[model samples]
Target: MKTTSTDESSAGGVTPVAPDAATLESEKESMLRQPVAVWATALACVFAFMGIGLVDPILPAIAENLDAGPSQVSLLFTSYFAVTAVMMLVTGAVSSRVGGKRTLLTGLTLIVIFAALAGTSGSVGELVAFRAGWGLGNALFVATALAVIVAVASGGRAVAIILYEAALGLGMACGPLVGAVLGDLNWRGPFFGTAVLMLIALLVLVVKLPSTPVTGERTSFAAPLRALRHGGLFGVSFSALFYNFGFFTVLAYTPFLLDSGEYGIGLVFFGWGSALAVFSVFIAPVFQNRVGAANTTMLTLCGLVAVYVLLGVFHGTPWVVTVLVVVSGALLGVNNTMYTEMAMSVSDNPQPVASAAYNFVRWMGGVIAPFASTELAEKFDPSVPYFTAAAAAVVAVTVMLFTRSAVEVHGPHAV
Candidate 1:
């Protein structure tokens, strides 16, 4: 007679055996073993995230070398993010037409060329123009990368997202260090450095990743805008807008506040970025798991307000300012993760369309805050920008509070 395995039961049996420990462990391991194409895309994501903080340590240097005012120099961020926000509208349209592989290559090529051109610029205006082109490339790459990763990765969308977030956190943590090391030599060094690294990523992606076939109907240019009409998506997008104003204010303005040199500034921000990485990857899940995504978002926004207030009050003390900046990173990390999860789940629209709409709206805050913060410091007081940022955080908290029911119905909690 044949013997039955643990997974099998006799006819008319009343009990079933659970999966054995060895089988469960094998399943867990399979989730981590991604294909080569997934790894290549994830590597590219790291380089892309690094670009966000790559200029932080060099901001003051750029100003001094180019003989530009704080407000004018801040336009570097304004130009970059403004173009990125506008380009978000067209990314899905273009990607659906060209297919993901070609789209990735096109975006990477643009970044390589524009970043190199930015490094060669002698004037602030020239740099700003090149940065705008770079922003457009970034918009294309980022919007498509997620869909590709999820399509290719094993263990489903959740695993792919975790890999993406890990790349983001690691890149963010390292960007300042890379900038400081290069920017210490020359302000243009970081720009050139980015170009070189992205070129390598481009090469790896081209060689290793197979071409992804275009599937489904093409996305419309107006799809993202139309997605925003949904109340849940609209609420999350606008709430993130207010939150991002505070986030970018701190990120773009704090270098000027510190009297420390390039290396010191990089070290301080490294600590900040590391804290952000830790909280985003580890702590955020715990908080969201316990309190739910909506409540966690509100709590983090309140934490940001408190941190910004402390920064404003202790503006004169370098040590205090540095400490608060690092602490603020944890708050930012939590908010970023929660907002992203909420945006993805909060609407009935296609996931890519919802993502594009959310990004387009929130990045507008990034475009505004850097230039506005510098102008405010020039006109009113140095600390006014932080106070303004605090106010923005308050607005975010208020929005979340009012939209709590809708957020719960449509947010990560629903998953």
Candidate 2:
């Protein structure tokens, strides 16, 4: 009897190992079941985004306690967003040289340092300056976070983008609730809490995230600016600039309108953030698949315009204002998801370069609108800020309509 050491077929040929059914099932797992690195990065993303709305619940508290005016307290957002906007121009340059993972860590470290410092601020000016530092950290992380997620996530780009937006929504939703809880104890608590949460995220990322290899390619500081030559990218970025004016008006100015105290304002915006999260994750894809990305963006921008108009009309009625704020979150979600997809896909420029370019432009709205809205409200009335935002929204819609052809993707182009 001749016994073969190797497992051979009856014909004396080696039998290949067949993958098990379980192995195939694992291979086909859904987007929810991602790798450790993806989850770690996404978790960090949630914490990072929380910083956006963290101050909303405490805006009134800060203004009252610090003995500062609405416009002065509003500078918190002004300084933060202004720094964030400027930093976007160089994120690609930094990340390309040091690599994505290190860049993320560096950003996280800055946030930890700045958030703690912000907690100890004795005046609005000090707080605003520290918040600017936080924005610097946020820009580095925010610019790199999407790229890391896209690079590591399974399924596809659509799934990855959705995940990133979901993180944004969750962070936004939770930010106010957390701020209310902590800020009620002391206005400084939220800042310290943010520092702790970010520190945890930083440590988790260091362990779970694998190193990203340096490609030895350095993006110039002007690379993001040069990316704007693409008609599609430029169209998306320009329209987003005006669109954000309306969006930030809603976010930064509405707290004073609510005047509901810390907990009440927190709950209201929590509901708003929840709406944003739900629509961006569940509803945005449905609309995009039905109407196409550019069309969806325009439709949502129109919806935002109507919302702003209603806000202007009902500024005196707190109930109506609250309801409008929640509803606007839904429209904002759709627009945000569509705008991001278009910016990433619209041009052949590298994803980092495109994001840096797109953000550099769009964030200008965030920089201007917060203080601008407060100043408008001070000079005229609360309704005037909403009206100003409505006009900006109208301009946004017109710009998109004119540039629709440049940004149209696989969807129908009726807009």
Candidate 3:
């Protein structure tokens, strides 16, 4: 007679040891305290965040060197995201099939390879192609990394979630300035530098990362497309999209503005970037807990209002502009983190789709910011991008307040 493995009947058991789905979940929850898994998850996050942002601060240089103007430059972000959106839809089930760690490693490797290629590219067209490659790796890494962490992290329940969020906060704060300084060396330097960082990150994951089995029924490709048919999360994703447009427009373009010695935009971005990095450490957990994601989102939107209002009002003053950018960057950090978390908080499958949708929103901004801000600047004034971004952030906040919560977020402390 052949013997049966509990492994065979273990998941969603036909005749489970537990009484119901709730009880089974409780039992599995007991196994979540793994330390190595937490570390691996953090490593992966650093790689992706750094990769995503590494080119940011150098947008001015890229535009000048590539023989592209501002509006045209923004296409870098837009096209990269367009690629990611497609990849995210496909990678979820692939992660389920191959296992999260393997999929993550493969994605990380691709990031390293293409990022180096991005650095070597001699022409604008080639650089753009490399960026598209970056988006592909990013979508794969991000789509699966969170789910892996959630399943594997040790100690407190969902400690991986907190760690993952922290890693993102750190990355958002650092990516742009790193791009700025390294950007002075070569536009390619920061990207290649990111590839180096990713290489180290991969090595760390090799020893530390633990594999997690995908538990739920895999949603088919048609499902995500079908999801677009429903409007709520899709709308929220676009809200994030516009916010990125506003933020990155400032982030990417400010250096150029200040390099001209007029608005002192460079100083503004530097200060703003610093504020974002610092605040991310201090108030993230508290803000999320107290105001809740939606309310905090409202608060962040208010900050954007101040940013563009100041930018539009005082386009010529470096001091005033720098102050505004700093405030904007800090609040943008909060907004990015909160909106991302909130977007997922409302989702039924929070980890994977949340990552996918949030990235989608962020990249949409990237795609639009460079071009739209540049175009708007040409027609009306340089400050138009700020105003446009502000208006969009406001719209997103409004919708979240009125919209049904798509996800119910409870941190480890909820119990």
lDDT: which candidate is best?
2
Q: Between which residue pairs do clashes occur in model 2?
A: none
TM-score of each: 0.91, 0.92, 0.81
User: Candidate 1 has what TM-score?
Assistant: 0.91
TM-score: model 2 vs. ground truth: 0.92
Candidate 2 residues lying further than 4 Å off, grouped into runs, are 1-29, 409-415
Clashing pairs in 3: 33-154, 34-154, 71-371, 78-367, 263-318, 268-322, 272-326, 345-407, 346-406, 346-407
For candidate 1, write residues 13-50 as lDDT tens digits: 11212345564354347557989999999999889888
Worst 10 contiguous positions by lDDT, candidate 1: 9-18
TM-score of 3: 0.81
Query: What is the Cα-based lDDT of residue 303 in candidate 3?
Result: 75
- Order of quality (TM-score): 2, 1, 3
CA lDDT of every candidate: 0.83, 0.86, 0.64
Stretches > 4 Å off in candidate 1 = 1-31
